[model samples]
Target: MAYFDQMGCKKRKRGERVFKFKTFGEQGHPVEFKGSFRQNVKSLLAFGNLGNSLCGGLASWSFQLEVHRNPPEHILLFVVEEPIEVSLNRHCKHCLHVGWGNHMICNKKYHFLVSSKETVATCFGYYEGNCNESYSGTAGKFNLVEFQGHVMHGVFHSNGFGHLLCINGVEMGSDLAGYQIMEFWDRLCTGLQARKVSLTDNSRKRSMDLRLLYGVAYSEPWFGRWGYKFGRGSFGVTQQMYRKAIQAIQNIPLCLLAQQFGNSSHDIPSMFSRYQTLSGHFLITLRDLLRFMLELKACLPSENGSIDTYHSGVLVDTTCRWSPKRVEMATRVIVEALKKAEFRWVSRQEVRDAARAYIGDTGLLDFVLKSLGNHVVGNYLVHRCLNPVTKVLEYCLEDISNGFFPSQEGSVTNDSELRTRYKITRAQLLKDMFCLYSHFLQEQKSMMNTGIFATTSLASRVILNSKYLIKEYCGKLPSLIQVGLGENSDVYCTIRVSHDGEVDEGRRKVIVPHECFMLRNNTTFNELMLEAEKSFKEIYFGLRNFSIKSIANLNAEGTDLVFKVVKVGGELVFEGSAGENGLNDEDVLEGFRRDSVVDCPCGAKYDDGERMVSCDVCEVWQHTWCVGIPDAAEIPSIYVCGRCEKDILEFPSLP
Candidate 1:
């Protein structure tokens, strides 16, 4: 207290960015809290009852932080605290070394946060998504962290950043919607020592995603105020960048006398970045970096636009007059074209060329196409990106199984487009994303239902209505580009995979253009196997996995030098790889739907690790449930499934 008071500590004013409070501590504890911010904290009342691990050693975890999610509309915002247990998945054991930590199954995931009342609840749903166990390995962590109950729940990486996966309840118009969210978010970020939260809006129209459907003070515009959403291929101010710059600049000695010059203000970005402050509580902003220390001023728009100070934020407010009804009326015009499209996915150009006959207004035509997100309405579903190599396509996620995906729904063909480097551009993709966002606005102004929505868009109203945050965000995300959508294209390369045995097989070289679209690194063992299937048919016989290595770096071992080369432009085609596959109950994943020979009465395969039994009469395998039995129930000495019993019983009855 004596230190801060003498050093110019003061109460935070109404609009100023700088503020200091009374009270101080040794700062040795993991999560030290001062009394002032206590009122804003949310308490996890049943933390003790939940009984989670304190310092971790119970099992293993990649990370140990809290997660917050926006549940679908039907889910209750506040419910009685439900019991949440965590566990690990044995099937996922192979990935433990790779950073896919303990999953939530057999009580392996519940590790409680201590005395911090901010941890009042512990109700994250069925399983953990991201790697929350040991930090060494990363599973490109994307986990389904369902909220069992409570406003905020779930365990995430303690040292990881906050990810706002979805935006819900905001349109419901509750003042507390944004308040509770911010409270939980702030607590999560503060505890994790994270600088900013990352949230992306990927709504492609059709399904009425909440990112759209709100106005002036709600929806995406609302989040705009607190955070800056950069444009295409943009990034935020990161500690990694600062550390890199500091490492580079530290070699140059500080020019102490240079600070005395009249031009010190311009040197602040350099000065603030160069020196590390003695105080541990404060966070430096981009604004602070540019005109921070020298001006002796506080942080201030960062504008929520770009990572740098020069660029401004972007806001999209489109006025669309389109709706489900309009598309229906123009059915003969649009549906006819969609039906005749060649590929499973239709491109925007294909759409324009097809609908040009009946659609008179160019803007209206464009809006109709853009608004048709990858979701199934009455006739068509908005299908997007396609993969030619894998023959797998992404349909409007809103309704992948809307009775129409690969199959036709009544009249409209299940259409998607191949986003090969030749067809789609980064600029076009970014433009279309915002264009679909505008679709929400265009919902035939009358259909916007703003009159009733006046009561909705809850969170945004709460955030702006009451200047809860002093440095309010400017209701705009100037940059709305998806990640990995850069100008960089795939290069033609040669990959030589050698078989282990010395007799028949030796090595086969796959000389193909490295793919740019696949989520995994350009080339992988499975990909090489698939590409060289004709050449290495015997090697890839049943479920044989291979070790892949780049011919260029064939000799590089597990030394740090190889890592350095890979970090730079150097490509390290590691032996082999994989990702966290979701727990699909029915066991059939359309994404991995290759040809299969499982003859179950129930038209499902991909087992997802469900129990299966052999039918004694026919010698065919069937899922326990499909043949009238429990998964854990004991099997009969001589079991006969319904399929086999049907014919035998019918034959006896006929005789």
Candidate 2:
């Protein structure tokens, strides 16, 4: 016979008959056999006695294998520490433990027999649905030794309840085989602290099936005969339950982690370490739940119309009224939180300044003030000089005044007709109103301490200058007329009056005839002369005449060169020329002869065949038609020439 060890078979012999035997050992460690087969076999069988004695009546045994063969045979042996009941059953003569022997029947020897106490578990049946069939099991018993180990005792409770059954010492059960091995280990560790460990292979699979139900119920509560129920304050029990389930999963080793670190059978240390971090995983899940709750709350309807669930909770009536006060409150809360957080705080003044800057020159402050209505804040601002309404009014009036009547000259004449037509008074009421409002704003609270009024004044001056230029060229009238000016019209002329009551007419003096001067007609020559004289006097009121060294006559005829003779140094002197080129020219002499047939100054006949007559003195002939003369028949006498007549008058004694 050959002694069987944990590894395989070992050679053995007795006396003259050689025997082969096989042996088994604990956990696969080889057991050494000494001496003959009968001696070692007896010793190996006695090894169970030592375990039984040490366990104090609790059954214990050792695994042993022996094999017998022909001459020159080999003996195989194996040893293991097991319960005494397994050893007794294997050696009992009348027991059906023949399969537990280490000897092979033919060429093959028995590897090892599973102790009767080892549990045998296998998948029985699976349910079909949305749930994973790998997780579900049916009520039925089946031989499972091929899958795991042999079953010791099995029984089905009443009505398929309490299906608990113990197997051999090995922890093989349906719970262990129901799900993947990794998942099985995961669920095994979840409720480990409660001492309610489920060693069955179906533990993980059953939990997974339960989790599927949880998921389905969470999504469609009515599908599982459950009514819809929202959680208090936006957090629901279903969400919590889901979180718990995830937490349970995290308690197990992640498949990737396990594959990397665990061994083929079991790796308790690494699994324990992974399970220790379950609290952190739970915290992460909690954070995710909180985020989900916040998102849900944000999407929920508040003061707005109820949400329409028909289209997956879309808001149909979007015309919801939001409370400004509530919005402000919420904003304040957020701001406070932000301030308290690890960041900087933004001041209210800074925000206001930012808003003001954003508005730029749009005058939004005025708009805000105007829209404030009769609120307490509005009233307070009005009392405190911070009133935007008053400020806008002041700005508007100032703009109008500065943009209309600008200079004293243009202001008086522009829009004179419109002023009259509209029956408007030229009083500075608009300007005064703006000034009073500005004064009120400044004196009440001094909101602008940097002399904004001065800036306004400067801007007003610029505007006034611009308006004056526009009125001057375009002939547009000012909004208001001056006191003495007529209505705005083209007939009006702007005349500047000096401190001495003299008017300025550009390079000359000009006096206003009357406010209604443009309304008059049929002016006489005397009246024209008097008006011209008055205009000149008014224009050159205090101007002194420039000293003239000599007076030169321009190319003109007749009295065009009138002489004002004066004896500056006791001498007879004429300031102008004589004869036709001077004051006493032929043209002047011709005016004196009404009907006289005067010869031309070039000594030509009055009636020349070529429409031209010759002058006798200067010898220059000009045609009567060319000279614009009416008729020669209108002359009384044709006697003296033009130049001869002038010479006779200039020097009468010599003539």
Candidate 3:
């Protein structure tokens, strides 16, 4: 993942904002203001909810700023210069009392309070005589004014259901932003519930990155990355459009499904519940996946196939009630029974495909998904996303909250009102986490690798793969799980699996058997390879235990499901045994859609490099083997295809 490529950690200036917004408007009509920051203060206030919201936090701190003469260059500047040391809760007249001050060696590490005023929260730090140097400014020089580190203020106190640790606000300097914020949330959040944890976040940042000074591959609004939400921010958004955005935000795609039929009720929380996998979502070469499979001596995966690892002696069948919780034991054995592997993504589809291939039952997969919020990635478009929701889960792997309360010692304001205020509800926290995930996806779309195949406006939902949690939550497996493409989904994909031979040097003596397989769902180039590998054995390309080559392309432009497809039980079934309760499946591929015309006029897509001959006349590349060239033939420097030869004969002056 090129996550860090566009990230910048340049220390922030003394009074700079966390981020800078491009415009206040949506897609077409950007709300650009020609007036000064002071002149537009009132206008900015009208955008978000007052007191505790997006730019409202800044506005509340600097409200009536247009009242003051020459209100400095920006809002934060005036906020820093003439501070308002008052808390958002007016009744708590003394919100900034010395609650408790414990001193440490270099800095005052552990001790602080919450302020609804984010600028005030930002000013909560005070390094005594032995502390390192802090930022400089007239107001900043006032040990009371300029505190650079992070300041997260909660409101949980003795009376009136106060100090519920509702996380009023947090202010962080640029130098210690992203990771530090993660640490803060980890300390405050309680824990998980049924392989699910909830947490909310709203990015108050608006970093002013001058394009003239630096070159970003791409950039978007702060919300477009972290709080990449659907509603409220857009201009003239009707309920219909909002609902549409909501529904599209769920299927993990932006399809125009009717509200009555769509997953309209699903939101970030829904996305969270459906998050399943825990492996690295990093994309690797198909050659790499094949290499990994070969190293493990793994057999090809089939939807109706039983789990069998011959080298590992792991045999898992799914018949007779999935054979009495036998899968539960096997699932543990492969993942945690022997050794709990590092948190890694586990593909739900991979497990389901093999289960369906083995037992010819979709119940197992349905049972697993039901436990994980029943999220379905509707179109091939969303399948391209890296499952942003899972990314949030991966980043915050540690148990942050203990159910409804914060994990940090001083986070709780009142144990009594914790349920009402501090309680991290599944609904709210899930919303925040989901927004963060959406933001992550948008950032990825703007990154260097994305094209129409990704970054499409239709993308909003990032469906998670949660096979890791299937057994944990899918208690008492159901008897006959029927799974298929959802309601009226007639779309089908045809994957053209041309052999990838780079991994097979002169060491192998075989031209990989030619074949094509229809893709079941949104798949990647690597998975196309995996299917080809299965076809190799499915067709008995070579003798058992003899290494065979098979890897190819989906023929479509491209789309990557950024999931770590965890292998089920590797090949334990032998020559003809399909294992207990397994179907003796023959190699068959169902195709859909006409193949798009690309590469050689012979209609073959690009093949292994050494086997392709570039036409010198038309300057178009062609598969040498497809153009009457021998498999063992070398490319001729001046070779021209038949079409080019005819064209040259018909018109001598043709360039």
Model 1 Cα lDDT, one tens digit per residue, 1-655: 1221222123213342211111111121222422111111112211112212222213212211222123211111221211122233222221121112121111112221211111122212111321266433322232223322223332322112123434322333222354445444444444333322344443223343332222221222234445533211111112233233322222222232123222534333222222212111121232122122212211221323211111001111344355534554453455456656633555556667767777776776665555444433322334556557655433222222222112223443222331121132333333433442332122324454354222222222222222111111111111111223343222222233333322112112121112111123344434533443322221121112333333344454332232222331233232221112312211211112223224665454323234567777766666676667885789777888776777887785554
Q: Lowest lDDT 10-mer window, candidate 2?
A: 466-475
- Backbone clashes for every candidate come to 47, 88, 44
Deviation (Å) of 43 in candidate 3: 37
Which TM-score value belongs to model 3?
Answer: 0.19
lDDT for model 3 comes to 0.27
Q: Is candidate 1 or candidate 2 better by lDDT?
A: 1
Whole-model alpha-carbon lDDT for candidate 1: 0.30
RMSD of 3: 33.6
Off by over 4 Å in 1: 1-147, 153-180, 183-210, 213-219, 226-571, 577-655
Positional deviation of 227 in candidate 1, in angstroms?
4.6
TM-score of 1: 0.23
Q: Residue 353 lDDT in model 2?
A: 46
Write the number of the candidate with greater lDDT, choosing between 2 and 3: 3
lDDT of 3 by residue, 52-103 (tens): 1212122223221111223221112122111122322112211111110010
Best first by lDDT, ranked: 1, 3, 2
What would the per-residue lDDT of candidate 2 be over residues 1-655, giving only the tens digit for each residue?
1112221221112222222122132211232432222222334445332222212223233333222233232321112232222222222111101111111111100111222212201111211121242312321222221233432222111101011122332134322222222232222112111111111111112112222222222331111222212111001113344344333322322333233234545442232221111111111221232223223333544523232111100111334343334322332322223234323323333333444543443343333333322211100111112335444221010111121111122211124443332221212222322332233111223343334334333322221111100001111221122222333111222222222222222212221111111212233223322333333233221111111112222222222212222111111111111112222111111112223242443333332223444454544545454444556644222333455667879885753
